[model samples]
Target: MAVRQRVVAGDEVTHVVLDREWKVIAPIEDYLEYLRQEQYSPHTVRSYAGGLASWWTLLEQRGQDWRHVGVDDLARFARRLRDRGSDPTVLALRPSKPAATSTVGSAVTAVLGFYRYHAIVGGVPAARQFYVHVTGGTMQSRSQYASFLGHIGGGQDRRVIGRRRGPSTPAPLLSPQQIAVIKDDAARFEDGNWLGDLRFRLLWSLLEETGVRIAEALLMRHRDWQPGTGTTAFIEVEPREDLRRRLRVKNQHFRRIYVGDELDDLYGEYLFLLAEHGFQFDDDDPIFINFYRGQIGRPLRAETVYDWIEGFKRRHPLLPAEWTPHWFRHFHATALLLAGIPPHVVQRRLGHQDINTLMRTYAHVTDDAEMRAAADWKMLIQRWGAAA
Candidate 1:
C-alpha cells in the first residue's frame, strides 16, 4: 500500500492506495470523508491520514490486524514513532528515532480516532475486538448502552498513550534594536528587488506595530484597513471564506487593531508603489501581492514570506535561527507591555480572546518592567537619604 498526497486548494489531502487495484481501503476512505464532513482543516486531515497509514503499514509488517491492537500495541506504536524522529527516510525504513513529544502524540491521537470511527460503525469483527467493555444507563426505564472502550476519554485504557512533553520553550523574543535591524534591511531595495523589499517592509512593519499573525497580514484587503476618518487608523481581521487559498486566523476572533503613523506611512508608500506597477487599487484587492512569476497581484502565500525571511536572515547572520514571522508578534506585545501599556489594551490589540492569556504569556516581559521600576525606586531612595 502507498499513501498518495493530493493538493486541493493549496492544502494536501492524503489517500491510501492498495496494490494493483489502486483503490483506497473503504474504512480509511470513509474516515477521511468523515473528517471532511466535520470540517477539520485540510492540514489536520492530512496529518491524521499519514499517521493512520503508518499504523496500517506497521500492522501489515507485524502480520497483525488493527482489531488485535491493545494497550501494549499502542505502546510499541509510540516507541516506533520515537525511534523515527522526523527523518522521512528512516521513518519509511523503520519508525525508529526519538521524535518530539508533540509529533508522536499527534500520530497516536490519529490512531485513536481511526479506531473510534470503526467502533461506532460496527459489523467489523476487528473493530469489535478492540473494545473490552460496554455499559448501559437507564432513563425512565429506557436504556441506552454505549461502548466503554475504544478511544473514549473513559475508555478501555489510556495508560499506553504517550505523555506529551511540557509546554514548549517560549520563542526567543527580538529586542527593539534587533527588530530595527530587520526593518532597515527590509526597507532597502536590493538589486531592483523593489517588490520584495516593499512587501517585507510592510509585513515587518505590520507585525511590529499591530501584532497580527502572518496569515492575517497576508489575507488583508484594501478595505480591511479603516483610516477611521476621525480618531485612528485600524485594520480589521475577520475570517474570509472566499480566498483562492484558504487562510485561517489563529483564534478566529474578529478584531480591529489600531496602527500608528509610522506603519500608516509605510503602507502609503507600498500602495503608491503598487499603483506605479499598474496594479489596480480595488477595495477587494489583496493588501499584499505576489511579486514574482505570473502570480503577481495574487495573495502572497505564507511559504513565500517565510522564504524571504529565511534569505534575509542568511544575509544578516545576526538574525536568530529560531526567529520567524510570529517572533515579531511577540516583539510587539513585549514592547507594549514594557512601555506600560495596560494588559487588557495589549490583549485587544493582539486579538487574544482573554486578557489573562496575554498577561500570562508576556509575564516575563512584565517582570523586566517591574525590575526596572524597582531599580528606579532604589536610586530615588538613595538620593533622598543623601539629601537628608
Candidate 2:
C-alpha cells in the first residue's frame, strides 16, 4: 500500500493508503467521512485512521502496492513482523503507546479491515478466508505460558487470580487531597484567562465526577444531556460507534449516569453560557466547543481535552500535577466507590460496560483497606466478640 500524501484542501494533507490485504486503497478522508456518515465518534475515526496509517507504512516498507497485494503477502508480512520480535500477545492488546506490547495488533487489523472493505466493495477478488489472523493478548499469552509450564512439570496449571482486595499491579491514581488541590487551583484561575477555561472546567468535572474517558466526554453532544426528568439527572453516555468498533464506555456498558449534585452547578452555568453564545442547546451542536484554536463552534476532539489537561498540569503547582487526565477518572471511580456508592452504581455512573472494569481499576486501592481492616480486627474481637 503506497501511502501517497495528497493535499485535499490546500496544505491539509490526506494520506491515501492500502489496507492489509493490499486490496482497498483509500484516502483516510474517505474513511473518516464513512465513519461520520455512520455516526461514529471522532475519536474512533482518528484511532481507526491511525491504525490504518501504520498498515500503510508497513505496506510501503514491503514495497507492495495495495492494489496488487494478496493473502500470501500479508502472511509473509506478519511473519516478518513476528521475526522482528513483535510479541504476539502485545499485538493482541493494541495499546496506544509506551506499553511494551502496544499497537501492533491494531496495525495488523487496519490492513485486514482495509482488505475486507475492499473485497466487499469490489476493489479486490475474494481473499477474506486467509487474511484475517487474530493476534494474542496478554491474558491469552499468560494462559498459554502457564499451560506450557504445566506440561513441562506434568502438573495442573494452578495459577489463580484471586480478588482478595487488589490487583497484583495497579495504575497509580490521584489522592483526594491532591485532587482537591487540583480542583481549587483550577477554580482559582480567573475567568477569561484561557480561551476554553470554562470548557476545561466542564471536561474536568466530567472526568472527576463521572469518571469517563476524556474521549467519551469529547464525543458528547448537546442532545445527549437532557433537562430535568422528574429530578433524575437526564444524561446519556452513548459510546461513539465510529471511534472504534469496540466501545468501552469505561469498559462497563453504554448507559446513563446521574450527574446529581457534583455536576449541577457546572451544568447550569454551562447551559447559560451555551445560550449566551447564540448556540442552540440542541442535539446537533457539540456540547463542548472547540475554542482552544481558531476552529470556533466546531465540535471538540479527544485530543483537545488532552491538550487542556496538559495545560492544566503546567499551570497547577499546588498539587502533584504530573498525573494524566486519565488519572482523574481513576480518582473519580475510587472516590465514588469509597464514598459508599455501590460498584454497580459507579459502573452505571461511569457508563462502564461491565463491573469487572470497576474491580480492575480500583483493585489497587487495597493497602488502605487492609490497614483499616487490621485496626478493626482487634477492636471488634475484644468489644463485639466473634460475631463482630
Best by TM-score: 1
The residue ranges of model 2 lying beyond 4 angstroms of the native Cα positions read 1-99, 104-168, 180-196, 227-230, 241-253, 317-322, 366-371, 380-388
Worst 10 residues of 2 by lDDT: 158-167
Report the Cα lDDT for residue 158, model 1. Answer: 27
lDDT of 1 at 256: 86
Tell me each candidate's TM-score. 0.74, 0.58
Q: For candidate 2, give the lDDT.
A: 0.57
Shift in Å, residue 360, candidate 2: 2.4
For candidate 2, report its TM-score.
0.58
Q: After superposition, how far is residue 215 of candidate 1 from its true place, in Å?
A: 1.6
